[model samples]
Structure formats: C-alpha cells, structure tokens
Target: MEWKTTSALSNQAIRTVGRIVEGSHDITIFSNTRAHPLSAQVAGIDIGRRTLTLRVFCPAGNIGDYLSDGLVSFDLEKINRDDPPLLLCFEKVQATCERIHSSLFEVRCTLADTLLITIKPGGVRVPFVLGMSASVSLDVYTGLTISARLCNLSVGGCMLEVPLEDSMPLTIHQQLPNIYIQFPNGEGLRSKGSIRNMRPFGRARHVAVGIRFIDLDRDMRQRLLYFITESEAELARRMGMENRRAGISPLFLVSPHDKKPANSNKRRNKLPPMAHAIKEVARQQHIILHCLKNERPFPEDMLYDSADTLLHLAESDRHQFLYALRYLSEEAAWVRHSVRVAALLGDVLPTQPGLVDDAREAVAGILLHAMGKPLLLSEHLPSLDTHLTASQRNLLKHHVEALRRQLHKVGWSPGPVLNRIVGDINERLDGSGYPAGKRAEALSELVRTASIIKIVDTLTHARNGRPALSPLDAYRWVYGNDGYDKKCLTRYVRRYGLYPVGSLVKYTGGFLAWVMELDREGSPRQVRVVKNLAFQDSKLDTVLADQDIQQIGKLEEVVDPANFQL
Candidate 1:
C-alpha cells in the first residue's frame, strides 16, 4: 500500500487525535493488506515521542504473525462526517506489540504521515435521570461482570457509566456478550454489544462506555424506540417548565453586573461541625453503597480509604464522631448506619492495647458488613416497632450469605480475619442469630466486639417508625442482653459513660446541653448548653465538676437529639 506523508499534522488533525486518545475511539490498523486490517483503539498518544499506543483486538490469536515485521499502517479519520476526510495516515511505521491477555494486544507505533477521512454520526441518544442500572458481562472466556448505569439510550446503541475501577480491564471495541438493564419501573431490556468508546466521566470517578447493539430483533427495537420517545418527551417537558419558571425569552437578558454574588458562606455558617462531617462522609459512602447494591465488585481500596478518614475523625475528636451520628439523613440509611457503627468502633477499639490491627479490620468490616441488607430489605430497614413476618425475617437473615456470594462473585477474599468479622457480626451467643447460629464459643473477639457495636448503634438510632433509645438506655439494653460479650460491654460503657460525649440531656433547671467531655470514670466534665429554661436557642459553654453537678442539678434525663432537631 502507498500512503501520502507529511512533516507535520495540521492543528485540526492534532486536536482530532487528542480527542481520539481521550475518548479511546476505535481506529483501523493495516499490516500488509487493507483486507487484513486489525481494529485497534487509541490507548494513549505521546506528543514528545511522536508515538501512539493502541490496544488492538486479535480474536484469531494471529497478532504475532501480523506484527512480526515490526511495521504497520493506519489512519486517523475525521471525527465528524461534515469535516474533510482523513486527518492523518501512516505507512510502514515502526511498531511493537505485547499480549495483554488471551485476545488483546497492546501495540505502540510512531506517527509518521497524514491523510484525511470522513465519518457519520449515530442516532439520537436520550439521556436518563431515573437511576437506571445495568449488568454487563464480557465474553464467556473472560467471565467478567460489570455493573454500570445507563447514561443514555437510542435505538441502535447506548452509553453506560461504569465505575472507574471496574473499567480498568476494559478496552475500546471489546466485546460485551451480555447486557441487562433494569429500569426503575420494573422494566428490563437485554442486549449484546461491543464497546465503541470510553472516556472519563464525573470527576474521573467513572468511565462512560459507548456500546453499539448488535442484531436487535423487531420487538427489542420497537421497545427501545418507544422508551426513547417517552424519555425525550419527559425531558422536553422539564426543560419547558424550567424555561417558564425563569421567564426565559430572547428579548429578555440579564446583565452580568446586575447579578448578585452567591452567599457561599451561608450554608457553612448554618451547618454545625457534626452536620458538616456527616455530609462529607455521606457523599463518600454513597458511591461505595451504589457499587455494592449493583452487585459490582467490592471496592476494597475505596473502603479502606474511607475507613482511614473515619478512623482519623474518630481518633482526633471522639465528640465529633459521636455527634455526627445524630445528623444521619434518612437517605442511604444502610450507609448511614454502617458508617455510624464504624465510627463508634473506631473510637472504642483503639483504646484496647492488644487489638490495634483488629481495630482496622473491624472498622472496615462494619462499614461493609450490612451491605446485603440494603439489597434484601428496603434502604431503610424496618424499625423495631414494625413486626416482620417469618419470611421477611428469613430474608433479612439471608443477607449474610448474599453479601458473601457477592464477594465471591468478584473473587474478593477480604482476608480470613476481616472475613470472619464480616461473616460473624450478626451471630449470637445464645444461638439465636441466623446463617449458622454460631454460639459464643465459636465467635472471635473481634466478632463479639462488632456485634456489640452494631446493636448499640442500631438501638440508639431512630429508624423508619421506631423511637431512638438514649445512649444510656441503649447501653443498658445491651448490658441486659445475653448474646453480647460482657467484657466488651464493660469496656464500652467505661469509655462512653452513661451519657456519651454527644448525648443530649436535660438538667434539673430545664437547660438542654450536649455532653462535650468525660472524665476517666466516664462522668461528664464539660457540657455545651444549647437551650435555656424557655427552650430558646442559646449557647453557653460550662466546665462541670462533681460539686457543680450537685449544686445546680444532676442530668435529669438523656434526651434524643432528633427531638430537638439537632
């Protein structure tokens, strides 16, 4: 084959190559003949080295034969059909190939020449905001399953937002043998396709993969068309409403100088330190929980990273950790509960001299242990006041196995110690717990500690319709229970006191205060009064000694923070 050569690429061609590399779009590489062209995707482009790295697909296992001569030819075509044909081309360019897996090869070649080409665009894609989820399985040989969200849909193809960690092994044009999409309304669509493009999305936390459906039957195409039409109409309706609300018109425009600066400090001032920390932690946990619920692989890296953050917060200020729990939102209830349990464990476990290593595993395990509960039950678990049927109870019990199977599917071994902690958290000493009903003798120390913390948090928090127990009452409930380890309970009480650091309490004089500091014996040493006798907003910091408590009034009662909108 003969090709035209150029000393340099035009600015337009340079921009096109950059887009191709960033988008990981497919390109064609020819070895000796155009008929034997190898399809490849741009992995990277090195402007300094003038080299292009391509991940070439070789289903026939003949890439070595094609690249034996260490030379190849390829072309970069125009991104849009309206543009001039052929952006760049190369002939007999020096190249090398290395096998990545069974049918994938990474090929690097130097850029040499230029040509021009044209391309056509695809059908209109309807983006979704309804939180549709997808399960994608690669070819049977790879046995890799990817959990993704539908970004947009069309008759011929769709775009998927895959978790960035899960997209690491995927290459452009890689065959996805199976894709199952589940809509919020219980509708499901199945198809087979190959990836056409991949690019970073949403702060580089996820990758958007463009997939072209192959051989859709009439019924599937009709359904897809119907969905797209409905989605488009809905989108148009929303846009129209927003425009009307803003009184949008070509005749009316706002001057930049007339606009007021945003009050960025307003929110910061309104939210308390505990509330701010809860919001930050909630944002991180949302991603982790989303992955788990979608049956995606356990994000161990993200889990540990979040664990470190939670542990640091717990260690640096036990008050902040406990106080943050009071601000948990009803959204992502599982995540909220798990995080609370983890934070509590982070504070309590470190004080033990011998259990330092176990503390890390225990905190991480607590964060993810109830992962299957959200999938099995509602996002907000039924309150203790709600009576569950035997079937429902059984279903809840099965979450342990559900979580274990999810981990197994991704071939994730959370190590024996962490595994044991996650697996045995719900087990009881009296053989009352489900999923093997292991007795106290079989449970490890870490598991025992985890069980105690889980119960304490569960009881201390208000759920769907149940009232939250005061910290003292919650501790008393656990102390009365036979399933928990007494030694762990003793240590827990000693560390947190009858009224924990974050406990809201009413004094004899009708003053409402939050416990801020506790002495070695677990007595409150300092308190922040937030309400006066009239129940009005007030702030008064006071240091308390044993004599002060007797002189004023003892803490009349431990109150629920939620009751005061704390």
Candidate 2:
C-alpha cells in the first residue's frame, strides 16, 4: 500500500499503535544501509492515517552518527496479539528533524515507497527521543541512584544524555537494577529497565544511554503519560524559542576524531556486483553452518543458492571469495577449518605444477569435501580411530554419498572431477578406506589434491573438542597414514614447517605466537604474539615487529593451549 497517501491506518496498524500507547512498547528499525539496528519508541499515533511519527534514537552512533545519516531506509517492526503477526516493512523511509535539546534531535519518519506487509511476529519496536525535565535514578533498588537528566522519552523507554561527571560502571544490557523517575509536577514513576544501547554524545563530553523500561504498573504508566501529554506545549516552545540554539540542530553532534561538514557524502560500503554476490553466498554459508550446528531445518533454496554462489565464485575472484569466508563470524570454527584446508591445498598444488591451472576447482572441491560429516548427529557418527563403532563406520563409508545429497539439494554438482573428489576423500590406495575403497590404480590422480585436505583436517581437529595437538604431534599422526599421498605431505611440511600457518606455538621466552610462515631452516620466521607469559597481562594479539625479532633468540616447544599455564 502507498503509505504516504493512505488515509486510514490498517486495522493491524491501529492495533499496533494502541499497544504502543497502552504500555508504551518499544520498536526496532532495520535499516538496509546501517550496520546496527536503530532502537526507537513511538512519540505519537495518527488514528486517521494509520501513520505513526517515530523519534529515532541515538544510543550508539554518537548523536553525530545518528543525525548525519538523516534517516535510512528500513522496515519498522513490532509485535501484537494477532493470529499471523504484524510487520510493516518500507522500501525507504524519509525523515525531518528539529532540535529538542542540546544533545537530542526530534525526528519524524515517513514512508518513501509503498509498504510491504508480512505475517511474522517476532520482535517489538517503538521510537522515542526526549526533551524533558526529569530526575532519573538508576539501580534505585540497590541504594545507588545515578542522577541523570532526560534527553528523550518514549512511553516504552527514554534516552538520557548523561554527563561524564560520574564514571559509574555502565555497560549495555546492564539492568537498571532499579529506577525512580521524578517528574516536574512532584509526580513520580518507578520502573525496572535495562540498557538497550549507549553512544558518545560528543567528544569527551557526555554519553547517550538508552533504557528500556520493563513491567510498567498502572500508577507508573499514568504518571508518565500525564507528564508527557501535559508538558508537550512547553517542550515545543523550548524547541522553537531560540533561533540560534535551534540553528545547531543540523550541526549533528560530531566526534572529535571525525570533523566533517554537514553536507559531506556518506561513507560508501556498497560492494561491486561480483563481490556482492560472493558476499551473499558467504553470508548464507555462515547461516547454513549455524543451522547445521544447531540442527535446525536447513532451507533448501538458501542452501542451493549458497552452493551456486561458491561454484560461481570458483570461475574467478576465488581469492577474494576465500578472504570473505575467512572473516565470517570470528567464532566460526568450521570456516576457519575450511580456510586452513584450502591453504594446505594451495601449498601442495605448487608441488604438482600440472594442477596449478585447475587450482580453482581443486580449492572448491576441498572446501566442500568434508561438508557431509556435519549433517549427522554425534550419536550416529563413527570413530575414525581403532575402536570404530558400527554407526561411526557406517557414516564413514557413506559420508561421501551424504555430501552428494547435500549438493543435489542445492541443485548443484561440483563438476565431474570435483564431484568425485568430494566423495573420494575417504577412498585409499590399499582399499582400507570406506564407502568406495578403490585401489591406487582405480583411484583418479585427483585423489592427490584431496589428500592434502585429509592431512590438514586431522591437525585442525586434533583432539576434537579438546585442545588441538602441537604441530609436531599432528604431523606425526598423519605422516605415515596409508590413505595419504606421501609426496603431498612432504611438500606441505617443507613449505609450512612442522608448524603450519595458523598453528599456535610457544617461543623461547614462554610467550605464545601463531606461526605465519617459515624460513629456509624452518624456524618460525614470522609470528603473531598472542600471549605474553613474561608480562602475563600486558598487551595481547600483537605481531612482533621485524626489527624486534632479533632481540629474542631460539624457540620453545609446540604446546597445546589447554596444558599451558599463563
């Protein structure tokens, strides 16, 4: 529907508004252009147009970041008692602004395009910016009340531009252990709340804090309503009275570091088309991993598209695509594993120069080679070592087939050779490997590429959930394994050293570093020091400058972090 010209609010919109006023619920804004959600509260409702004016929040983006963005395209979300659910998504949202206080801006939102409606009740939202006179007490129940002035207020919550006078330990999501809000009329309201967001109000000046009120009792609600409605006129006058002060509305509270003109264009983040498509695939891949880890039902279409994205990426720009995958959700253990295996293959392929041109397809196959294992429950998995359980052995044999099904579900085939490689990682020369235990002559030469992945997989997941083995121990375990190709393993060790890239190692001074590369002698020529046993608690996650490396001589043992005492 054309939200701008629509004369009346839809019944669903009207109900959402009523709920906002009844208890002052909160709303969340999902802006396409912004990385963070704009938490807001409802300021007023239009019963006639089914439209609501929102007071955008400034809790994180520094009051400067919020105002300069001047409203982004976003879908507004809230929850109500309905069968399907309520969601009001807009193609674009426009805004007009006015200064409500020295640190707060009062803005109203309008739809830039027709609204898109969907039935999916998930989260609630409301917009509120404050220009009011109130004494705020936080954590009141604990006898520690923070004296703060209100900058913006909504029925569901309020934004306080707190001065840096008292450096109380404030953190996001920290509960207002207790609150007592004192109004101008000697009326008061006490409520429970938690920090929704916080941002710098200005450089070395004050901070903006967003507090979402919880469990508003009838008495507290009435007092809040009375103060909001009764003082509306004075608030408007205050906003309108001073021309010079009002002139600063567009000044946008800026940071000390970023001093730019108001009209300066926004920083661009739109990726190139090819990069954009790869990004989408990487994003979906991360989500798919999350679903698999949590055992949620994986969407067939999303999975299929993600596969297509990975395959499309293989044609060119493969390095860029791999880099994007490396940065996915820092905690993505599986993504890290995939990159390690890909890098291992990258190191080995040089030994076999003939495979260099086909490296892209090789990398693609290696990435998805082990994709089938994660799809099974732990109870159904077989032990890879000596005491193999029946289920474990069975899983090992058909794991390639399982991967094949996943590829089919995405309507993707990893090319003929790549398809075989994905399933053939388990097949060995001596016919000991399961599923299709083709003898050496029967196995295609492509098995050499998958061998590198197999070797690295053991190192990456040495002890499973336990601390991984040292680089030396990991190499020893897989070096003479019958299934692996000896030449590939030898080349890998020579290039990456016993400790390969991404391996954590200890040094002569009890410090820990991740080995980045090796010199001619295979000593760690470069390392990123992550733990300093000497200082114990100095700086961490740092790289030793090349000039400083000469000062530290010799190397220590390769130790598992779980056994290391810091």
Candidate 3:
C-alpha cells in the first residue's frame, strides 16, 4: 500500500521524521577513542527538548556501558527493501543523563536538523544529496587527480559534483579507470566507470558529471544494496513518526479482513502497529547478514536473542508476528525465500507438536537456514532457478561446510535443537541433498523436516521460474512417493491442504486469490484476493462474491503466479 505522511508543523505533507518524539530505533555509535562502532538503541525521544536517548549495548545481550558524551557521532539509516530508507547523520550538541535502570539508561542528546537521503534498491541511483565527496583518479591519465562531491549514487553509476574552480577538465565520455568513494562512515567503493551524463548545479558553480560503473563485483553490489536499504528505511521511519505525532492515520497500513476497509469512513479499533515491527526484523536480519558478508564471526548473541524474543511472544500476539513474517517476505526477495521456507516448516510443525517445544525456534532456524548461502557466495545472491551454472553448483556443494566454519569462527554455537535445524537443513533422507549426501539411516529424525523444506523450496523455485507448474501438480509430484517421508507428507496435507500459503490459484469465476490458511478439514480458511475481472483491490469484492471461497470449490486449477499480473 502507498503511504502518504506529513509533519504537523508544515503545510506541505513532508514524509519525513522531522522532530519525532518517543520513536524507537537502533543506531550505530562511533567514538573517537573506540576503534569499532558500538550498537545502541533510542531509549527515549523528546522532540520538545531537541534530544534523544542513546543506550549503548554489548554483543552479549547486556548493557555494559552508558555515556552522555557530545564527542560521539552516530551513523544511522532505515533499511527498506522496496523503498530506499532515509539516512541520517548527527552529533550530540549537548547531552544529559536523565535516569538509569538495569541495562537501560535514558541519556539525551540535542540533534541537528535530520538530513534525509534516498538510497536506491539494489544500489540503483535516484537523486541524492550532494554533500558526500570522493577521490577520483584516471587509470591511463596518471596526471589527473581530483576530489569531487557526490550528487547521486546508483549501483550502475554515480554523479560527481565538480566545482568550477578545480583545474581538472575532462571531455564527455571520459574513462575513469579508478574512482574511489569513501563515505563519512568509512564505507568505501572503488570501481571503474565511464562518463554517462553531466550538467550544472545552480548557484554553487558546481557541475554534476554522471559515471556508470563498468561491472561491479559481487561484494560491491551487496555493499551498495545495504547502504541503499539503510537510507530508505530511515526515511520511512521518520515519515511514520511524523504522521503519528500529527494524529494522522498510519502510513504503511495493510487491508486485512478484520481491519476497517480503506474505502470506509467508520471508526475501528486500530490493528497492532506493524510498520516498525517488520523494519526491526529487517534491521536485525541486515545486521546479521552484514556480519556474515564481511567475514565477521557469526553474531549468535543477537540472532539467538532475536529468536528468543519471538519464541516468548504470547500465543495471542503470534498472529502479528506471523503477519510481520509475511510482510518481510514481500519486502526483499532474499528475505522472501527464507520466510517462505520458515513459514512452511512452522505450519506443519504443530501437527506433530511433540517433535519441537517452541515452533518459533524451528521457524527462526529455517528462516536463517540460508545464511550458509551468503557465507559460501560471499555477497553474491543466488538465482531462484533450477538450472544453475557450474560455479553456482560448486558454491552450493560446500555451503554446509562453510556454515559450520562460519559459526565456529564467530565464537558462538547454536544449541542442540536449533543447531540440528539449521546445521543439516540441506541434507535429505534419500541422500540427494548437498554438503553431505548421507543416507536416511544415518540422518537424525530432524532430517525429515529438512526433507519437507526441500519440497517447499523446490515447488517455490520452480513456480517462480520460467517454466512453471501448478501448485497442485507441484504438490502431487513432490509428495507422490517421492524423497519426502510418507509421514511428513501426510501431516503436511492434513494441515495446509492442497494449496500452500503463497500459492496462486485460478477460479472458474475468473478471480485469483492467494491461499492463506487452512481449516481442520483441510479446506482453505482464508485467502486474500489478488486479482479479479474488475481489476481493483479484490479483498472487498471477494468478501461480497464468496465466503470461504475455497469451500465453494470452483478452483479450476492452481496456477503459476507469472501467468497473471499479481
């Protein structure tokens, strides 16, 4: 859904977190004396006082240090997958200690006016602020050396702000053998690029020259993506904050059946606020992935703690948690895969409740099961196709080994149950899986869950590919005396029915709805209509046309999502 937000002070609806109060966010704290950045949280926000509380945290899930020093600088960004996050950099003008509690402190800092930046998804370039500078040097033209500010940065290219006073003058289509850009946070990018476009900026006697990167390596692309996600997410947070303060409706609102309709003017009890919830999850996932990508040790403390938080959630609030997982799947494709795999496992886990005590742990383990992929690929994203090339296959082959080494390197261990879930995720009972083709006899009972995941993974991959299979056909083929154990297959069908969540379906009435959940009798309990003959948001339309639409049994077939515009 498109979110429209504005600050109360401005007549213009500026979608920014300008002077937000009581908003929660994680931040990176860098000190002149400390070598590495410290992780922190915004404990309290007071817009009237022009200050925010920053509570420093240790990696071991405890607050070890607290400070109100003005010398510290913070580098923070919102990490959004679909939209670029807003990035902010600020220093403490003045700080005061308000109060202290166990592992929590209320320190306040006066902030400068927040600076908003738009970071492109996938490192693509949109317009950006021109405050950042970079060092430029030509490969062949050794005599050329110039420092220029940045106008914008995309994965493929970036525009440099050249001041008119600089002596360096180059013609159009100039080849820059090496361009090194160092962010204020010390994140740097070095790439070869060619001049694509150039123009003049007003009043500053500055010229904007655009350069397109020739071919970015895997690591560079991931870095750019992370940077962009961070920037966009921050802006989204600010927008949300401003709207709330102004007493406006939510910006990132979803239209669930229980909630009031978008078209209705009726008052309704507010659904649990979910925009920040998903962003928090995304931020946690991003942090862990960054650690893994940088060859840093696994952040077991953070990962385990995040999982525990989810595990301990009350049964009533589990719906919100599950909804957040669905939103995360839609936000980022990499995350989408993990959430789907995790959801599928979580759905069937309760069928045999004795197997696992906390289903959330299994869900968390499955969600992060693909961490090995990044450890093996080292920032290169894997394709969602079956026909991977030779090198890709080799990378998948040793992913298990890489995951083990990575965990050990991080100086932490996942406990026995979760370790089993994530450790042997790729290993199959029939010995067709990767990292170790151990037979079913030698595998643990937990290996059967891995087998269920294999089918989920296979069906989703093929359904999302060029040549697709209907969900029913895919289900029948994968479970029909296949590699999956008969017991697991029976449990899966009994719980989730023929169509799974994320499955696209066709109806005789010419409507398409995603299968959401199932009943005790294995019929579709809920579905959010995606398309219809009218082509508007179909949720309300479906409500009018069919109740428990799956029970009407007009399901012509389960179809590939690619065939229709969803």
Residue 140 displacement in candidate 2 (angstroms): 39
Q: How would the candidate models be sorted by lDDT, starting from the highest? A: 1, 2, 3
How much does candidate 3 score in TM-score?
A: 0.59
What are the per-residue Cα lDDT tens digits for candidate 2 across 268-299?
12333544454444444444443333233444
Worst 10 residues of 1 by lDDT: 113-122
Tell how far residue 337 is off in model 2, in angstroms: 2.1
Poorly placed runs, candidate 1 (over 4 Å): 1-279, 295-297, 329-331, 377-390, 528-554
Q: How does each model score on lDDT?
A: 0.63, 0.51, 0.51
Give TM-scores for every candidate, taking all chains together and pairing residue i with residue i: 0.55, 0.48, 0.59
**Deviation in Å, model 3, residue 190 alpha carbon:** 9.5
Per residue, candidate 3 scores C-alpha lDDT tens digits across 93-142 of 35555435543455456543333222333233333321222334434245
How accurate locally is residue 168 in candidate 3, as Cα lDDT from 0 to 100?
23
